[model samples]
Target: MGQGKTSLVQRLYQRAVARYWARSARSAATARLAVLRQQSQKAQDLRRHLNRVIAVSQSRLALPLIGSNSFPRPHGTDWAWRPELWRQPLDRVGIASVANRESLGAEVTLFHDCAVSEVTLRQIRNTREADLAPFGVSMDVLGFDGSFLSLVVDLPDEAVRGLKRSHVIRLDTIVEQESPLEIFVRLNVKHGPNTEQVVHELPVNQEVNTVEFDLAYTKLNEKRVEKAWVDLIFEGPEMNRVILRDATFSRRPRAEF
Candidate 1:
């Protein structure tokens, strides 16, 4: 049953209680006791109905994770085996390191304060990859003391050549901070003789947030978009750790329903 049905039953139960109270005023003691008992029974029936509906709703939502012929495990030592409810896709990508000591990739690097501990990059594989290549990409970075962390991803000309022009670039981030912090997304576009760099600011409170960069508005010289790179800059107080789960580019932009 849906929420509407549950609400209707609750309303009916309240009406029954009211009717019982009204009749008890003039009825004999035995009759009043019977009326109270009936009201209790109706309340119990509503509670049972609610429980059944909730169970059905949860089962429906979990159908995707609960594959055929296997029982779903709530938690496991392997992170991938854990249930989907606790997984945050954006916090799953990139490469993780401690302080500014480790390089994420050939073109990517991380730097952070020693005080801020535990930074990670994780990737949440989309449906296509989950069924075909069941693996996740992640990076964990830890900061000690106060430090600056930067991530640089090199995008070669060949990489962007075939990319759809109407795509949306999305970044998922989780921030753990005692104070407010400023995060930056810098885009550097390099064409043969021309180079354009743009920086976007993302301010994060003590909350998890998702930021989307719309590339459609970016007037890239379609013919000269030879090479590009994105730099994520983090600057803030000590003990501020940020986790980046996923960064994805999709050709489909969200439309209003």
Candidate 2:
């Protein structure tokens, strides 16, 4: 009987030990799962923090670069200044008016074929937050049935005098767009009854913004030159908001070879 009792006691001890080990294994697995969850959350949080820091740094860095003009010039510069759009407020700024009659401050006119019924143009004052000049042109295009939308700038009569073939006309502009649209910039010279035009395709990148007109190639009648003008035309510009942040005109004589 004692031997049987000893055998039973040994069996009971083995079962208790097995149960204890299984429980310990389950507890260890639970602990490992909890640690993994905590680690994953921490990693995600760290990524979010890093992204925020990077955004803040980039924005602050761009601040100093605003309103800065740096162009390469091998020849002596004749003129460099911002367009009339930024120098002062328009006589009429906030209201949307007929493109034909929209007086965009001095020396500039906004013109579009979209019937007076379907076009909207507003001159918005650029807040200090934009880090831009004093004003920007805003256009909301809807049902644009027109063949072309353009802003015409009439150059002063003085621009034609003392203007030689060796001089180059350069235009600098800043445009902010909501949708991608092609823009054509043209410089028109009217001497007597003949008008000669030079067209340039504005770059696709928003930051891209200068166009150069070399007068040497044109057969311009300097003596008969009576008028000068610029055209900014937008093609396929439906349902878009285009902001002209700033524009400047400059001329420099080409370096003699």
Candidate 3:
């Protein structure tokens, strides 16, 4: 028998059993027993019919079973099963650091190299504003040999001047080893030289630190923001590596509370 024929028979048998059960409730006790036996016989016949159909048509079917092995059994029941295609582990390696040379410009590439030696990068979701957030974007150089390391960012003049209110600029740093460090944040506005140039001293021995540059209290003209840059200056000690995990610039509206 074919699959189609077998399915038709099964459906007819089920319908017959249902109809008999519904009518048998009003029948006598002996009639009820006879109806039950007939239903059981119908179920057995259906099973036999399906077996015959399988033997003749050579159709495939799946059956779940128990196993004692570490891996679970495949969802299907086939003799020629290939385990490699469906049951295999996936690689879960992650990237360290990334730099956008195009945006940084060609002239600035010679001064510094963006890398991730002892850090990791990840993508963030469900952020309030932007879709993606950067992780492990900063660098921590040892020995402080480099003379100048600056990041130049181009911005629209309208956005710079529109920032009349105070905002918080955050920089995340991790100190692998101890050394004296000086950090400077300078904002270059449009039609102006350097507006807000503030220098802050880092701690001698600290695990992890977060440096926040508040633009509210500073002498920054938010209405004239055309080109901006951040300069990181390291002073003292000839050997030490600072791991900058991440740096983000976000605006936090002043709270009344």
Which has the greatest TM-score? 2
Tens-digit lDDT string for candidate 1 (139-199): 4433435555666766544445644345444443444454466778777667667765667
Residue by residue across 1-257, what tens digits does model 2's lDDT show? 65446677788998996786566556655667776577557657866988999976664454324344433433577766555555555677654545565666777777876665366667666554544455567777766777878878777665666777787888877888888899999999887888878899998757548899998888888778887888999898878878787767777888787
What is the full ranking by lDDT, best candidate first?
2, 1, 3
Q: Which stretches of model 3 miss by more than 4 angstroms? A: 1-161, 178-194
Superior by TM-score: candidate 2 or candidate 3: 2
> In model 2, which residue pairs have backbone atoms overlapping below 3 Å?
none
Report every candidate's CA lDDT.
0.50, 0.72, 0.40
Compute each candidate's TM-score over C-alphas. 0.41, 0.66, 0.38
- Which 10-residue window of candidate 2 scores lowest in summed lDDT? 62-71
Residues 151-224 of candidate 3: C-alpha lDDT, one tens digit per residue:
33333232244454355544434333445555444444342565555445556566455555566677766655
| Error in Å for residue 110 of model 3 | 7.5
Best by lDDT: 2
